[model samples]
Target: MPLLEISGLTQRFGGLQALTDFSCRLEEGELVGLIGPNGAGKTTVFNIVSGFYKPSAGQVVFAGRETNGLKPHRITALGMARTFQNIRLWHDMTVLDNVRLARSAWLGYGLWSAVLRTPGYFRAEKAIEKRARDVLEMMALTHYADEFPKNLPYGLQRRVELARALAGNPRLLLLDEPAAGLNSADADDLIRLIRWLHDEFKLTIWMIEHQMKVVMSLCQRLTVIDFGRVIASGLPQEVRNSPEVIKAYLGDDTL
Candidate 1:
């Protein structure tokens, strides 16, 4: 079965329809891109899949199970995780703490176990710390573990967010505008890091990004949406060459 399958997803915000009849699937170990102009409904799909919003109509199946109404935390526990367009790390939390919190949600331990500090809780805490530290190290952010996200450079802050997502050991990862607000150097680093993580952990990543360089370099396939509808879907170069895609993106300067 596909790692993720979204079928006929439609979202309506009162009178505004954010998405309509959108369907996509990600096979295991694939890297895919979802792109579109501003207000093009890319984020809406991510939001719905991540359980932030219930779709007006459609089904989301992950690993062969329907996930339309599952909570975000429950989905994470099921081996899916996502990062946001904006950095969503807690400014007051240390980098390690941020990572730990994410892993904590999916770790094995009852609420009472934690409250009582049972042996199971201690074991679970140890597991969470080890997983968090390992992810930070893999992302090359170990030295900044004790630092606050607010103090890190933009690139490192982005890495911390990625580390938090990785701490859960997700099989399917959704990245929303990961390269936003970065310099060329940082963007290049992000491209390399994402590629390495995909290969190293065998992760299936689906991203929504406007930065053409990042998308073209990292994605194996590209899906383009315009005004909440799919306009193109194919190989990266093929989609880039599509007349409809070029028109939607308004020429190659952004494509």
Candidate 2:
């Protein structure tokens, strides 16, 4: 079965249609790319799937469960996790603390127990720390776990976001422009890490990436959207050669 399925999804903001009848599917353990020019509604689609925005019409079935209109937290509890376009780390917290916060969702402790530091709370905290440590190591950020987000380089900060998302134990991961502001070397590392995580964690990944290099190299399938609709969907090379995709990007000089 497909890990994700979207059919006839639409969203409108006033008179402007942000997404119109957008539909797509992702299979188990698949790594797919969502690419489009600026204002193509790529992020809008992500928002709908991640439960940040409700679709005006249609269904978002994830893991065979209808997810439309679900709150973001409820969607997350269903084994879906996402990273934002902008880094959302707690700038004041240490890297370990930031990721530990993500693991808190699964920690079995109540507010009173945590505040009182009961034996159960201590055990949960320890287990959370261990899981957070494992995630940091997986992302190769173990050495910098003690550093604050502001102290790390931009590339490492992005990795920290990935670590936090993974800390949630998601079956499906959505990344919005994971390589947005990185140098060539950093982008390359990000691509490798994404591929590595998919295999190691048995994850299905769906990402919105404008970096052609990263998208082409990392994704097994590609979906291109323009003007809030799918323009092309196929293998990377096929989508890259598509005239509509070329014009979509070419028409917008800023893309």
Q: lDDT for every model?
A: 0.92, 0.92
Query: 222, model 1: CA deviation in Å?
Result: 0.7
Clashes of each: 0, 0
Error at 167, model 1, angstroms = 0.3
Tens-digit lDDT string for candidate 1 (111-207): 8997999999999889888888888888888899999999999888888999999888899999999999999999999999999999988999999
Error of 1 at 57 (Å): 0.6
Per-residue CA lDDT of candidate 2, range 64-170, in tens? 99998789888898899889998889999999999999875587999999789999999999999999999988788899999999988888899999999999999
Worst 10 residues of 2 by lDDT: 246-255
TM-score of each: 0.96, 0.95
List RMSD in Å for every model shown: 2.4, 2.3
